[model samples]
Target: MNLAEEIQKRRTFGIISHPDAGKTTLTEKLLLFGGAIKTAGAVKSNKIDRHATSDFMEIEKQRGISVATSVMGFNYKDVKINLLDTPGHQDFAEDTYRTLTAVDSVVMVIDCVKGVEIQTEKLMEVCRMRNTPVMVFINKLDREGQDPYDLLDEIEEKLNIQVHPMSWPIGMGKSFQGVYSLYEKKLLLFQASKQKLDDTDTISIENVNDPILNDLLGQSSAAKLREDVELVDGVYSDLDLNAYKNGEVAPVFFGSAVNNFGVRELLDCFINIAPPPLDRETELRQINPTENKFSGFVFKIHANMDPKHRNRIAFVRVCAGIFQRGQNYHHVRLDKNFRFSNATAFMAQSKEIIDEAFPGDIVGLYDTGNLKIGDTLSEGEKGMYKGIPSFSPEIFREVINMDAMKTKQLEKGLMQLMDEGVAQLFTYEMGSRKVVGTVGALQFEVIQHRLKHEYNATCRFAPINLYKACWISSENKKKMDEFVDSKYRHIAQDKDGKRVFMAETKAWLQMVQDNFPEINYHFTSEF
Candidate 1:
């Protein structure tokens, strides 16, 4: 295929949800439809040792929660779909925010029992800021949950977006039978499988009032669904592709990810309606995907996927053009040109070598500890992408190596973790001691766990009496020097040698801002 044709055939999106909302299960079912995995593995299973494909970390397997973002690509119905599975837990919102920058749309999974939770609200706000389209998947229909109409109303009210029901469930809970498709005017009934994953089922009826549907679902359910269909057709808003693409309306779907019901219908509609590779804003201008030359940006860097080899992989989202292996590209941040001889694509933890990739494709590049988050790479020009922001850490702790003799090892581990964007690492001027800052308390545990398990460097964490971290910059060089020397507040420097202040309370933060009105004390930094 030509460059334009190849770019047009790609669809990129992210999967986001609150914890335990069946996000991972929905991801597995979508992969099954794409033929990426023959048998889907349950996220937390006692009978089978297998875990979900997206949760690849040892810690994730043990905790049965996703802590990092994963990128997986597959071909479904003649279209290349790049699916990014982000952490559902609130602690990993920083990582999820970064992953959102690389995709054109998002599939938000909400539990039917719990409408919209805290993490879902935060994630949806991020998408709203980016004007990224969202598709809602109301999962867990097999189990008892909220009424479908009430759930849809909650989504519309809480998310502040118009909801258009693309597919509606016939009967929920133990009485659940199948889904009634609104667009196709068909009834899809499913049979539960006794195997590890649900087997694909194919039973379609032309009319919602069919006798077979009444037989599959109870007569009352069939009549109720028919009445609901008429109500939706008369009152509910129709599917508006333009409104969806503009992030004003979301097309909602009802399904049971475990039973694999309504999954294929969602996938088929997603690929057809989801937007393709769009323009990305850079410092220079908006870079269109149809551009001939290759351009991309690094949104995430993960270290120690293989603990034995201690490998570092930089995930780059191809934005503008075609990327070919063994081709040199300008590293805009490093101000140097380098070639990636081993450009690989990911299937969760496993990856394979690929010859070329197009726009909206995320390829992993091997790194020897040089790449930083938000670094831009281009084959044509030297310009940086904009709007990748760094969030302020909500917690602070002092890190100490358990063994003083392994200080170098500790430093190495800390450097690698910092480069991976795990958290913000800061150092004071008086001593070699370093402090770690994170947006959530769970990150401190992850940092210590990784240090001991992957690096074999055990460490102790000491909670610090800090409330806020701020980045300080000013045009007056003398004022900046004086502010750095002031002992009124604790001071530190980030990895890039930028000065930062750690305040102990809201009063202290306000005092600093009030005192230094000329200086910029930013809570978050933009790259």
Candidate 2:
């Protein structure tokens, strides 16, 4: 297909919000309304198992929150929509950042009552930094103690973005109705009763084609829709929509994603207004070792289900030319080349075999053989794609020593943990003895559980004082110069002649680097 044609065929967007803001509910409703799943499933109960597409982790189910990014794809109006459902908790914020690297836009979901919280602010900042277009979905209109207008104002004031309402809630709290599409200027009312697709739910398309639906269909009659279209046109008047038929304005659609209220309309709006991959600004970056060679970046990774081939699956975003299976591609981080024996397109968890993939498409390859996060796969020259920022473990604890017989198993499990990118492994050795470092106290519990379950190695843990080194500028040039040259960590005296040692460090620095890599290493050692 032509680039423009392909652009019109797919939509890539992510769902983000603060914790308990109804993001997963919204995701399920989207799947149900888009016909990806037959039933709407609740995260609380893994009812259908299929509806839990985004929350695939056991910890997420136990904790009742998303811990890692879950990817799902569905079709609306012949246009494929790839949805990246991100974690809302502050601890897993790194997963959100990594997910955003592969998406073109975001559908920011917010709880009406909470408005914007710390996580929301952090996510908005990332979106702004990336210049990714955003659409806000003020959710939980059905819950008590919510004010849509107030939330809208908060979003505008805090985020400093245009708060053009594409859809407005008809009522708030218990009296919540459906939504009025501000752009379409029409009200979307959902059936009060649950809709089950059988003989009754099926309606003839010809019979449903009435004047009201016609009005909803036409751009001119839909006042709010027309206004939105016009506003976008005024902003890009010189740019003709027909010239770039796939291009569209950022649209916000409101609905109770939990009750499946106004969900169909929202999906329709997404297919109608969201820009296709081809129309988006082509992100130019190095893909391989050869400066001119074609390469792609893997955005998501999965483990295959089959026992024989239950290896790592790399989901690649083709940034440049075509990539074929069984070809050797350089892994930028590992500094080695691995061959993708089988490359395929992923439909949720299902894999579709494909020989090659082009730019603007997401494909999965199995047995990437030591491939890692931020590793670029290219044919000839060594070029690097920006790596996904590492996520910091918010909590930390120390692992107690295990028996000698189980030490090897513990090390193997640590390697597995590192491979998953869920936690970091820090090993300190003192005369053949080793100590492992983790993010927080709770992580030690998880590590112990994993050991018991996976390796049958039981262990205990203790809370240790998370130590750090700090320095004060006493301005003692002689001491500072001496400290800089020594291999052993030396005390630096600044101009004020005060000694600076490792005593001032804290665990907070690790968390800062984990959450905010954009500024982590920007300064030199002297600074």
Best by TM-score: 1
> Against the true structure, candidate 2 has what lDDT?
0.59
Per-structure clash totals for the candidates = 0, 34
Q: Which ten-residue region of model 1 has the weakest summed lDDT?
A: 193-202
Q: List the residue pairs that clash in candidate 1.
A: none
TM-scores of the models, in the order given: 0.97, 0.74
Report the Cα RMSD per candidate: 1.6, 8.1
User: Over 4 Å off in model 2, which ranges?
Assistant: 46-51, 192-250, 278-294, 300-310, 334-336, 391-395, 401-403, 429-451, 454-461, 467-527
Report the lDDT tens digits of candidate 1 across residue range 262-295.
8888998999999999999999999999999999
Error of 1 at 191 (Å): 1.9
Global lDDT of each candidate:
0.87, 0.59
lDDT measured at residue 495 in model 2 versus the true structure, 0 to 100: 20
lDDT of 2 at 21: 88
Query: Candidate 2: deviation at residue 208, Å?
Result: 20
